[model samples]
Target: MRTILITGPGGSGRTTVAAATALRAAGEGTPTLVVGADRTDTLGAALGAATGPEPTRITPNLTAWRPDAAARFREDLTAFQTRAANVLDLLGASRLDAEELTPLPGAEELSLLRAVRDAALSERHELLVVDLPPTPRALDLLALPEELRRYLRRLLPPERQAARALRPVLGRLAGVPMPADWLYETAARWDVELAAVEAVLGDRRTAVRLVAEPGPAGADAVRTARLGLALRGLPTETLIANRVLPEAVPLHGLLAQQRKALAEWTDALPVSPVAHLGHDPRGADDLAALAVPGVNTGHPPVEWPVVDRTAEDGVLVWHVPLPGAIRDDLDLVRRGDEVVITVGGFRRIVALPSALRRCTVAGAALRDGELRLRFAPDPQLWPR
Candidate 1:
């Protein structure tokens, strides 16, 4: 299955583009599912159908779904309370009812991400089209699985969980409470779930389609978004310049600026200009007429590998592709088995390959949008 995530600056008509793209794919006889993250019925309006948490057939081969974040939040909290009932009873704590629960700040995004993961893994749909939040929020949402997995590993290392039988004995001997068996079980389950979601995100069949209006703000947003996406090694399929004014419109200056933006985008990725609809697009026919082109999915970037040059320079170079990274904002550090990379405001800690872990960072450089680090093998650590 191919998963295409569509996002852009808010009010850039990304949902409309997403609907049209799914409609086009369905028209070609592909089984396509369009998933939306909006709290309001934006996607339903574009598809001219009512959508909810359940998947609804919008057309012959297209299905649309809007994740009910509030409901999911309630369900999750209620289940959690049930799981911890024993502890709550001992503490005389009252369990909150689901009816009184409301979704917290990031609950909607978490629900949307879970839906995306499930849809991507399901065999029912050949194509999954997701209408993600605007660029900033979407980036954060996409990065969540990896970040959470990292936290889980740090808090409850799997190695420690392996000795579950000794936990009680050790806790009694130390006269302190170790993590309960249920806590370890919960961590293991969460890690598995997060790994599945991360797999979907890092899958070769998944790619991103960026939609933006053709103007200064949109251009700036795209550029900033590109840096973030590149740092994460997310492949961009195309740039959809949505709501482009016609050439003959009274706003000739705006049209000229759009032309310039389109040309610039063409050089970066496939540029597909969606003309201004004058009114919000409604119904399948209108969406189909919009002619939003689909893109071929590209495999995500390969991992940074150690290129040994021991014979010539006694150095190993690790090459990491960061397409839009600014040289001034880049930072690299080697900490034990993990290398911490900071690009702009985003940071990721990636574990080094076994061979690279025995080496020390000698120097680093950002050239041609790729960050290359030179490492020297430690004589004492390298296998004789």
Candidate 2:
């Protein structure tokens, strides 16, 4: 399945563009599902279809759904609360009500991501177009997998025998159960779910299209988001510059100033192909016109090469070909849960795969424009 996620700052016409893309795909007889992650009926209304929580057939090959992210948030809250309560009970704490467990600020965003993953995996649609939240929130949603993976790894099991040895003693002294096995099992389940999500997001077929207006601020935001997505290994295919003024606009003082600003912004942007649309693209026809070149024919701008996994010199090695990358401009940093990479004036943040994150980086090398980073098995961090 292929998923195209459209995101930009609010009022940048992301939803409109998303709707149009879906319409064009559907018109071409492609089975397309457009998901309104904004929790608004704007996308459905544009298609001239009645909006509902359930997926509505807007056209012959197009379906729309305004997923109730709030409902999904509540469901996730309930599940987490139940698990927390079980853990507390096992530790011999007083019963706590689910209502008392307040969710963190980003909980809803995480729930929305889970909903998106579920929708994409559904068998109902061949092409999934997501009208994502605004840039900042969208980045957070995309980063949730790495965050959750780290949290689960820590909470499910502690490092060292000292942690395990103290658990029983502490439980006995405090008159609690201290069931470590249950925590491990819970973490294991979460690991499986997160792995599935990571796989989906990491797939090159899943493309993120960033929408922005023709201005300095919009360009800056797009660059940041592009780098963030790359860091997380999410493929960002195209950048859309919406709301460009018509060429026929009369040159007045303010109009001239605006035009000059747009010209400078366009020139200053990173060296990536961008699509420009006149005004906000709303309704089916507007979006159809704004469709990226070759998108309707299933050709994407960025093509990700396949990686080969094999063993070399008694060590497991995976070769990912990143052709055309300059070795001199390449820089890498291993942060807590992410790998920050800078190459040829472009930066990308990459979330480490579970296996790689657990292993220590044995060495790194750049040869023939291919950067190779080796990871050695860390017995201490590996799952039991």
Candidate 3:
């Protein structure tokens, strides 16, 4: 399934663009599902129909959903409490009621990821359109699956589970009760779900369609979004310049500013300009008028290749492709076998490969949209 993730700066009409894109695909006879991630029903408002937990059929080929994120969070929490009932009973603690529980921060992102995975794996939809949160939040959401998986592995190493029967004996010696089996079981389940979500996001058929009203602020937001997406190895399919003033109209003021911004963006990236609807777009008619493009076959994931320069430079170069990263804003530090790289204001900790683990960072530089880090073999760790 092809997934189109739409996001932009706040108030950029990204939800409208996502709706238009999904509607267009369905009109063309393709089965499509549009999922929205918003605390409010912004997507439903754009569609001019109420959406909820159950899928709402807009057109014969189109379906829309705004999953009940709060409900999902509450269900997970309830299950956790049930699994640890013995522990709570022993400690004389009260269990949280499902009715009183609310989703904490980050629940929406996890919910959105699960919805995407479910829709894609269902094999019922040919295309999936996602109305993602604003640019900053969407980037963080996309990174969550991988980051959470890493944390899960560190906190509950799978190999340690091999000694499950020995846990009681070890606990007795330590004079403290070991964690219950359910804890490890829960962690394992979460890891599997997160991995599935990551696979869907990293699929070649998945791509980001950035929607922004062409202007100075929009330009900066797009630059930041592109840098963040690149760091996470996600490909951007198209930049949708939202609410573009019609070319037929005489250019002046805001219209003139849009032209300049569009020209700059067009010179650099593939851009799709969505004309202004004269008012906030609503219903099928308004969406059809926008005429957004169909889903794009996204670009291949970026590769971090290790180039050998042992003979001449006595170091290996790790080339990381960062299309819009600023040189001066790049910084990195090698910690153990992982490198924490900060580009602009975004940071990601990437674990090194087995070969690179034995090498020490010699130098790093940004050249032609790529960050190159040269690593020399560590005398202590490298085979002598």
Identify the candidate with maximal lDDT.
Answer: 3
Measured on C-alpha atoms, candidate 2 has an lDDT of 0.67
Report RMSD for candidate 3. 1.9
- Give me candidate 3's TM-score against the actual structure: 0.94
lDDT of 3 by residue, 1-384 (tens): 988889999999999999999999999899999999987888999998988898999889999999889999999999999999999999999999999999899888888899999998988889999999999999999999989999999998988889999999999999999877898999999999998998988888888989999999999999899889889988888899989888677767777788888998998778988889899999999999995876655566667899999999899999998878888898898988899989989999999977899988898889878999999998898777
Clashes of each: 0, 3, 0
Candidate 1, residues 1-384, lDDT tens digits: the string is 898989999999999999999999998889999999998999999999989989999888999999899999999889888888888897899999988999999899888888888888899989999999999999999889899999998899988978888988999999987887777888898888888888888888888889999888888888888878876768777889999888889887888888888887787777888888889899987897796986454555445567888889989998887877889998887788998999978888888878888888889989977888888999999877
**Residue 281 shift from truth in candidate 2, angstroms:** 4.9
Candidate numbers sorted by TM-score from highest down:
1, 3, 2
| Model 2 per-residue lDDT tens digits across residues 1-384 | 778888998887788778877887788777988888765677876666666678888888998887665566666656655768856676687753554555567655666566677877789778888888898788777777767887877665534323667888889999976656556666777777777777777666788878877666775676567655654556666666666555576646545654655664455432222345544555666566664433532323333232324345423343433434556777888887677777655555656666676666666676653567777766798655
lDDT of 2 at 337: 63
lDDT per prediction? 0.87, 0.67, 0.90
Q: In model 1, which range of ten residues has the least summed lDDT?
A: 295-304
- Candidate 2 off by > 4 Å: 80-104, 158-182, 252-282, 289-384
Q: Distance (Å) between predicted and true CA of 176, model 2?
A: 6.4
Pairs clashing within candidate 2: 231-349, 231-350, 232-349
Per-residue lDDT, model 2, residue 205, is 76
